[model samples]
Target chain A: MRGAVLHAPGDVRIEQLPDPAIVEPTDAIVRLSATCVCGSDLWPYRGINEVTEPTPIGHEYCGVVEEVGPGVSSVRPGQFVIGSFIASDNTCPHCRAGYQSACAHKVGMTGAQAELLRVPHADGTLVATPDDPDPELLPSLLTLSDVMGTGWFAAVAAGVRPGMTVAVVGDGAVGLLGVLSARRMGAERIIAMSRHEPRQKLATEFGATDVVPERGDDAVARIHDLTDGVGADAVLECVGTGEAMTQAIRSTRAGGGVGFVGVPHGVSIPGGRLFATMVRLHGGPAPVRRFLPDLIDATLRGEIDPGRVFDLDLPLDEVAEGYRAMDERRAIKAYLRP
Target chain B: MRGAVLHAPGDVRIEQLPDPAIVEPTDAIVRLSATCVCGSDLWPYRGINEVTEPTPIGHEYCGVVEEVGPGVSSVRPGQFVIGSFIASDNTCPHCRAGYQSACAHKVGMTGAQAELLRVPHADGTLVATPDDPDPELLPSLLTLSDVMGTGWFAAVAAGVRPGMTVAVVGDGAVGLLGVLSARRMGAERIIAMSRHEPRQKLATEFGATDVVPERGDDAVARIHDLTDGVGADAVLECVGTGEAMTQAIRSTRAGGGVGFVGVPHGVSIPGGRLFATMVRLHGGPAPVRRFLPDLIDATLRGEIDPGRVFDLDLPLDEVAEGYRAMDERRAIKAYLRP
Candidate 1:
């Protein structure tokens, strides 16, 4: 099998690797039908996350089960399925409470940017589709494994409800999906903060009622102006920068909520400021598994086309180009056909 | 009128001051029946909070209305009332949403240690008692103005529910009252982190099921151990220190909630750590006014005695001694009879 590995910062290469094998009774091996480069993958490529050795990359996947261990009875071989970045037993208290990422005995699924991937706790981690998805629906299904699910989690965590006004503070694929999620959750208005024209267009298409191209304090002021200075009822911090987080907090009404899903970097939240803001804060590595079933159904029903996030695609062998294009913002998301 | 003034750090003095009169159309003059030194007051007396000049102090009060402006119709002279530290118009969207402390027209009440104090937005800020309280209940009612209300906010913000375990990370008057709030809210178990015997006794009296004397990491570990390594379901952070905040976050189970209400000084929360914790964060000045009516009812019916937190009492003329006693930790809280 061939897979992508990061030997050093800014260095990704495709090389022959041993195929994954199920060592646990609850594990299953799947032949990946679709996988993609994540924005978080850029952390290492941009030299933010240290890569000491050849590290297996990718954690999202949509695939067909090829084999199953003795204990795997719910999902059979040849079934189409999608799983989350974090694999969990799903029966634990945390998983039961819809926080699978923090589930007891949870495993971070990695090395999915390959032909085959081994999944643990298969019964709990992988959700089989009612039927095999259409070829065109694969891209959207793959997104349910991470980005789409994360965006949905962000909107839900922000307490978006019918008739509420929501504000999203990032223009990435997840941010765009957040607009969709908020809209689907019955939000009457959505403000997408984006400076990029292409991303802004997608945001608007996805249900952003207003677009604020400004950034930082100006963005907060503009949002306030748009909402009559009461600020948005729900603010989603899709970008983890300090400025983005601050804007998200400031653009929310005093008693509103902030759902921050961006992987934070160099962000030091002043406790005093958070205390004074009086806004509710909820975020983290989204428990994508919690929302995977609903997202998958949405995709299957053609209610949403999250696949639009993937603008560029390449063979697994051309993984380097996929990273490069995404790193330079030339692609909203890059899909890798294995 | 006599009031407490901070001439310098550690130099609280009793000074003659002009009687306050209704200035705003919505203002009401109150003859303070009880005022108390708060934990936050020590911040300025200890020079942590800058005392630039002779600043009038004290913000917590339970009193009898002395006079009312022409526009003040809800409250009148001879009526007993309890008000929040921050006066609010309670008409703005924020106030209507139960975040009165963050109301657009919020005003921080001061000089409550004086014989007479002027309360702004009296119609919104002051909640009248059903009837005059017995002198024995005066101390408890005084706490509802700030400390007790703040503690209740912490518990509610932390999402304490029936059958859940709650951990309180502070031994101050507010933390002790948080134990009471958690118990009244139906928390099955309440852990009070404290080393002070007096505070611990108060905590027990207020319904703390356990007292962990350890601080910092040890305290977090102890809480986890108590909860079978799952951590408490809700953690209240009542101390404004990095260690206390960290412990509060660490002592909560994944997907748990943390309510931090202490006036943070130099605390900077690392976003990454908070993101990894997957805990909900909510805190602030505490819309104390939202809970005033309930607290006032409970007090009148003799359901709770938060006034037990006040271990010492002094006359208004001994205001300096009141500050000294609280600053020296000789008194958990100092009550001034104005």
Candidate 2:
């Protein structure tokens, strides 16, 4: 099978790799129908993160179950399903408390940029759809695996409420989806902070009431202006930079919350500022497994079409081009047809 | 009137000062029955915090109302009241949302060390008992003004459950009170980290099921061992040091919470590590004003006694000795009667 492999920073290649198989009793093998590049993938692509080997590169996908191991009972072969980036047994205490990303026995799903993939904890990790979704819904369902779930977590963690003004600090696929999540969660006004035309347009279409083209302090000031002199009730820090965190903090009200879903790099939270502002900061990994069911339902019901974030598509053989298009800022996101 | 003032580091003096009078329509003058030295007071006393002028010292006090301004209807002259360190106008949206310390109209009551104090927002800030209590309850009532409220906030913020294990990372007045608060909140097992004989004794008396006399990583290891290697479900960080914060994080289970109330200095939150550990951090200047009434009711009903934290007592004139005793670690806390 062909897969996108990261040999080193800025060195992604479409190379022949062994096809994945169900190695564990709780695992299942699937033929991926759709997959996409993630904003986090760029972390390693930019050389900021260490790439030790030829790591499999994608974590978001929707597929048909080709085969299941002995213990896989919840899902059957040939069923259409959408799973989260983090696969969990979903029976642990943490998973029972709606924090499945921290399941006692959890596994990370990667290398989805291939024709076949192995999903662990299949009985508890995969959420089967009511019916096999049409090919047009493939991209949107694929997004529920990571980006959409993460966006939903960001809104929930920030405690966004009805009639609240929510500020999103990133223009990536997750940020655009965060705007949709906040809107669906009843935020009266959504402020999308972005400079990219494609992302800004998608954000507006995703229910962003306003768009702030500025960055940093200027962006915070614009958010305040849009929020009637008071800052937003919730600020979503979808960008992991220190400046982005600071902006997110400054853009929120004195007693509001900052829900951060960004995989932080070198950013540090200043305890003093957090105290004086009296803002609650709740975030970490997206607990994606907990939201997979709801997100897949939302997508199936056509309430949210997150796949709109993708502006470019390519065959699995051109996986490297897909990465390049997203890396060079030409495409908001790139979809790979396996 | 007499008051304790910090002219500079190591220069706390009790001297005659102008008597306080109502400055606002909602203000009330209180004749202090007792005041005490706090751990935070040592920050400025030890030169860790710069002192610009002779600032009035002490925020914790139990007193009786001497006079009421025009708008003060809830509190009457000669009424015995227990007030939080912050005087807040409870009509603000933030106060309505249960964060009175972050109220739009907030007034600091640090000068409560004086013989008489002018409390602003009297109607909303002061909570009066049905009748004046016996002199024996004075110390316990005083603790409710600051330390007890702060500790309760830490426990509540950490999301302590009815049948869970909790760990407190400090052993000062607030930390000891945290043990009491966790017990009241229904934590099945409370682990208090304290090496001092006096503090450990008080912690055990306050319902700490276990006392771990370790620090930092060792303490976290002990906590994990106590909780079957899963760590505590909740951790209260009452010490504002970097090491204490790290220990609190390491002592909690994955997907747990850390409620920190100590005033942070030079401490930082590592976003990536926190995300990976799945620990949720929530804290700040506690919403003491929000909990004052409930705590005052609990104290009047004799539900708990918090004054045991004070190991020494002296007349107001000996305020200097009180600071010295706390700074020298000779006393857990000192109470001054004016």
Candidate 3:
């Protein structure tokens, strides 16, 4: 099988790799129909995250089950499915509580970028669809594995409500998807912070009531101005950085909530500021599994097309080019066919 | 009128100051029946927080209204009242949403440790108790003005559930009261972090099922060990240090919630760790107004005695000694008869 591998920072390539198989009774093998380069993947591709080995990449996919282990029950051979980045034995207390990302028995589906991917805890991890989704719905369904789920989690975590003003502080696919999630959740006003034309357009199309091409303090001020100096009722920090976090906190009205979905490294919030501001912060990984069914159904019903974020597509062999286009900001998201 | 003034970091004294009158249409003058030294007061007393001018300290008190402004309607002269550290109008959207601490017309009632104090936004800031209570209930009722309500906020913020293991990460009066609050909220296990025998005794008396004397990483590990390596389901961070924040975060189970009521200054949370752990952090100034009625009822019902945390009492003239006793940790909390 051919898969994308990161031998080192800035050194991604397509290489022949051994196909995955069910090593555990709860595992299943799936032949990926489509996958995409994630914004997080850029962390290593841009030399921000250290890559020491030829690590398998990608954790988002829409696929058809190829084989299943003896214990696998919910998923069967030839079943069409969408799985989350974090695989969980959904029966655990944590998973039962809708925090699948922190499931007691959890596994990362990073090798999904390959033609054949092994999914653990298949019975609880993979959600089978009605059928092989319409070829056009593949992109939108694929995003449910991570970006779309993450955005939905952001809106939910932030407690976005009807008649509320929500501010999204990123322009990536996830941020654009967040605009969609906030809108679907009944947000009356959405201010998408974006500088790129393509993402801005998608953000607006996704129901962003306004787009403010500003960052940091300027962005916070714009949100406050839009909300009558009360700031946003909810702010989604999709971009993880000290600046983004501060802006998110500052852009929210006192007593409002901030749902931060960015993978923060060295970021820290000053205690006094958080306490004095009276804003509630709640966010982590999106329990994508919890929302997959509804999101998938929404996609099938043509209620939302989050896949619009994907603007470029390439054969699996040209995965490198896909990464390059995304890294260079030429595409909102890049889809790869296996 | 006599008032307590911080002449310096270590020097606090009761001296005759000009009598306070209702300068604003929303203000009221209250003759303080009781006030107390708070954990936050020690911030400046300990010199961790800069003290420049001869600041008037204390922000917790129960008093008898002496005069009311024209705009005051809910409260009137001669009413015995309990007021929060923050005097809010309770008319703004934030205040109406039950976050009076973030009220649009919020006023800090610092200097409540005085013979006479000016209460702002009297219509919504002061809650009168059912006509004159027994003098014995003074201390407990005084607590509802601040510590008790603050502690309750922590429990509510942490989302303490029945049969859940909850941890209070401070031994101060607020932390001890948090134990009481958790118990009231039906938390089955309350683990209080404390090395002080007096505080441990109060915590246990207030329903702390266990006391872990360890601090920082060791403390977090101990909490996990006590909870079968899963950590507490909810954690209350009442100490504002970075170490306390870290301990609070680490001591909670994955997907658990943390409510912080301590005034944070230098504390910060690493984004990656928080995200990966999937813990929700919510806190700020205690929305005391929201819990005042319930807490007051609890006190009046004799279901709890929050005032037990106070180990010393002195006349208002001995305000200096009261501050010293609390600042030096010689007393858990000190009651001041004004």
Candidate 4:
């Protein structure tokens, strides 16, 4: 099997690797139909996150099940399936409460940017489509593995409701999808904060009712100004920086909510500020598995086109270019054919 | 008129002061029916919070309206009323959204431990009872001014619901009432974290199903053990300390909520822990005004007895002893009569 591997900062290579086999009784081998480079992947590739050793990369994926262990009863071979980046048993108390990302028996996925990927807890983690989806729906379905689901979680966590004015920070794929999610949830006014022209256009197309091309305190001021000084009813923090979190908190009205989905790099919230602001804070790594079934159905029905976030598409062998394009900000996201 | 003044740390005196008069057209002067020393008062009394100068003390009171400015329309002279420690114009967007403490026009009340107290935004700040209550209902109605309402806010912010396991941190007056609030909210199993025997007994009387006499990590461990390693479904953080906040966060199950009403002094939450724990956080100064009407009605109906927290009753001239008793933890709370 061929897979992408991160050797060092800014160095990614496509190399032939041993094919993955069912390592656990609950494991399944998925032959990738599509996979994508995630913004989080840049952490190690940029050396911001230490690269202790060469490692297989990528976690977002959707594909046909090639084989399944006897213990896996929920999904069968040859079925098209989508699963969360993090595998969860789906039976623990946390999973039962719809926080599968924090499931008692959970596993973070890696080495998924490959032709064949091994997924543990297959019965609990993988959600099969009604049938094998069309090729056009592949990209959108692939996103259910992480990005789109994360965006949906952000909106849900922020308590975005009908007639709500929602603000989304960060213009990454997740943020753009958040604009879409808020729209789907019936938010009356959706504000997208982005400095880049192309991303701003995408945000508008994804149902952003307004756009503020500002950052930090400036962005907060813009939101307040836009909301008649009441701030937004809900704000999604898609970038995990302290600045982004602070801006998100400040941009929300008192009693509103801030759903933060970004993996924090260096964020610490002062208790006094949070208390004074009186905003609800809820977020974390998204429980993508919880949304896979509905999102997959929505994609198949053409209710949303989250796949448009994939501005760059590449063949499996060009995996190195996929990482480079995203790293250079030349691509919003890069989808790969395996 | 006479009022309590904090001259310095450990120095509270009952001194003669000018009787409060309407300074704002929206103000109302009330002759206090009752006042109480609060757990927060110890912050300055014990010198944990600096006493810059002789400041008029106390912010919780229930009283009879003695005079109303021309602009005041809600409560007339001779009416019995309860108002929050923080006054707010109930019509502001924040107040309309039920966060009166963060209202557009908010005023923190002081000199409330006096014979006559002036309240701002009277029409919006004060809730008049249906009629003058029996003397037995005065204390409970008085608690609706701050402590009871704050505890109710903590239970609400934590999203306590039927059959959920709830935990209360801090055995103070506010935490004790939180147990009662949770009970009223239909939480099936209420755990009160308190080491003091008296508080534990009071907690049991207030509907606490269990009592864990532990602090910090030990308390969190006890909660986990009580919930069969799942942690509490909701936690009320009534203590405004970093350790208490951390313990509350740790004691909640993933996807649970921590409603913190503590006035945080030196507390900071690490983004990493918050993200990984996956618990929702909501808090602030209690929007007591939002709950005042209902709480007042409940007190009048004889459904709740929040005033039981006041273990010591002192005359107005003994304000020094009222402060000293609470400061020394010799009394859970002290009620004052003019």
What are the per-model DockQ values?
0.82, 0.63, 0.71, 0.90
- TM-score of model 3 (first chain only): 0.99
Candidate 1 error regions (>4 Å): none
Candidate 1 chain B weakest ten by summed lDDT = B319-328
Per-residue error for A285 in candidate 4, Å, reads 0.8
Candidate with the greatest DockQ versus the true structure: 4
Residue-level lDDT for B162 in candidate 2 = 94
TM-score of chain A of 1: 0.99
Query: Residue A241 error for model 1, in Å?
Result: 1.7
lDDT of 3 by residue, B33-73 (tens): 99999999988888888989898889998889999989888
Writing each residue's lDDT as its tens digit, candidate 1 over B1-338 gives 88988878899888999999879899999999999898998999999988898999999998899999999989999999999999999999889989999999999988887888999999999999878889999999999999999999999999999999999999889899999999999999999999999998889988999999998888888998999778899999999888888999899987799999999988888888889988888998989999999999998899999998988888888988888888788988998988
TM-score against native, each model:
0.98, 0.96, 0.97, 0.99
| Alpha-carbon deviation at A334 in model 4, angstroms | 1.0
Tens digits of per-residue lDDT for model 4 on B1-338?
99999999999998999998899999999999999888888899899999998999999998899999999987899999889999999999999999999999999988888898999999999999888889988888888999999999999999999999999999999999999999999999999999999999999999999999988888888999999899999999999999999999999998899999989989999998899999999999999999987888788888899999989999989989988888778899999997
DockQ of prediction 4: 0.90
Alpha-carbon DockQ of candidate 2: 0.63
lDDT of 1 at B72: 91
**Top candidate (TM-score):** 4
Q: What is candidate 1's TM-score against the reference? A: 0.98
Model 1: per-residue Cα lDDT over A1-338, one tens digit each: 99999888878999999999989999999999999999999999888988888998999898999999999988999999999999999998889888999988999988989999999999999999998888999999999999999999999889899999999999998899999999999999999999899999999999999999999889989998998778899999888888889889888987788999999998888899889988888899999999988888889989999989999989999999999998999999999999
Off by over 4 Å in 4: none
The best candidate by lDDT is: 4
TM-score of 3: 0.97
Backbone clash pairs for candidate 2 read none
- The global C-alpha lDDT for each of the candidates, from Candidate 1 onward, is 0.92, 0.88, 0.89, 0.94
